[model samples]
Target: MFHVALTGLLTGLALIVAVGAQNAFLLRQGIRGEQVLPIVLTCLLSDVVAITAGVAGLGIVLERWPSVLPVAQVLGGLYLIAFGIHAAMRAWKPTALTTEGGASLTVGKAIVLTLALTWLNPHFYLDAVLMLGTVANSFGEDRWWFLSGTLLASLLWFFGLGYGARLLRGLFARPSAWRVLDSGIAVLMGVLGVGLLAH
Candidate 1:
């Protein structure tokens, strides 16, 4: 069980650390310190449910019906492209951001955005729901340990990212820093979105 859980922990970390909409948005919210708790909680819970659902057997459906992936890719790719453009525009504007206090988003808006950033992306389904589920089931009865590890990883990353962001408050305080960060996010999203569509 220890070994299985450890394997799942490492694997979960690997998958969650991917460059995606979730990370980008988290960084933004973290730096701003706006609705951090609610956002983080939402992300963590969403991940838990998604991972649990995957382990419960959603992966089998995806594997059997491969066409679902392409459809998701098309939708996700288009959304990513649009999001990327928005980020790029923000970069162009280059607003100064402060971790202590700044323009805070309403809790409702934050929740909606969080869900969209998490659930709308096809990559989330492919990686979190499909890949992780398949991997967990491979362990048979030991699958629960794998799921636990995944849950732990999600907890650590979300909390660390959401709270630890304060450490970078000084850096992100500058408008120039926001410009650079947003620019990178924009480029990443645009490229990945295009790749998904092309693939």
Candidate 2:
């Protein structure tokens, strides 16, 4: 069981450690010191629901309706493109960081954006649902242990990301740093969005 759990933890980290749309958004919010709690919880809960659903055989259902993923991909791709454009605009018009928490978003808005970024990404389903689900189910009766391990991975990551980002506040204090970060985010989103569409 411990071995199985360890496998789960490593797998989860491998899938999530990339600089994806979700991470980009969270990093921005964390640095700005805005609505971090709700965003982190939303991400963690989304992972729990997705991973559990996958282990409970959502993958089988998806296989039955093969069109589901493609449809999601198309929609998610378009959404990502639009979001990428928005990020690019931010990069073009960079803002200096302020101690007053400049241009902060409301908690409700932050949660909504977090949900959209999480759910509207086709890769989320691929990684969290189908891939993780298939792997967990392979653990047979110990799948729950695997599931627990994955959950722990998510818990550690989100809390660490959300809170740990605060450590970079000083670095992001410069306007140029903000521009560079937003530019990277834009490029990441655009590439991911196009990849989904072209896939």
Candidate with the greatest lDDT versus the true structure: 2
* Counted clashes in each candidate structure: 0, 0
Note the Cα lDDT for every prediction shown. Answer: 0.85, 0.88
Candidate 2 local lDDT, 1-199, one digit each (tens): 8999999999999998888889999998888888999999999999999999988889777767878889889988888888899878877764533424346788899999899899988889989999999999998999988999899999999999999999999998887788888888889899999999998
Q: Which stretches of candidate 1 lie above 4 Å from their native place? A: 94-103
The TM-scores, one per candidate, come to 0.92, 0.95
User: Model 1: per-residue lDDT, tens digit, 63-116?
Assistant: 899898888888878888988998788777634333443345799989987887
Task: State each model's C-alpha RMSD to the native.
Answer: 1.9, 1.4
**Model 2: pairs clashing at backbone N, Cα or C within 3 Å:** none
For model 1, state the Cα shift of residue 186 in Å: 1.2
Best by TM-score: 2
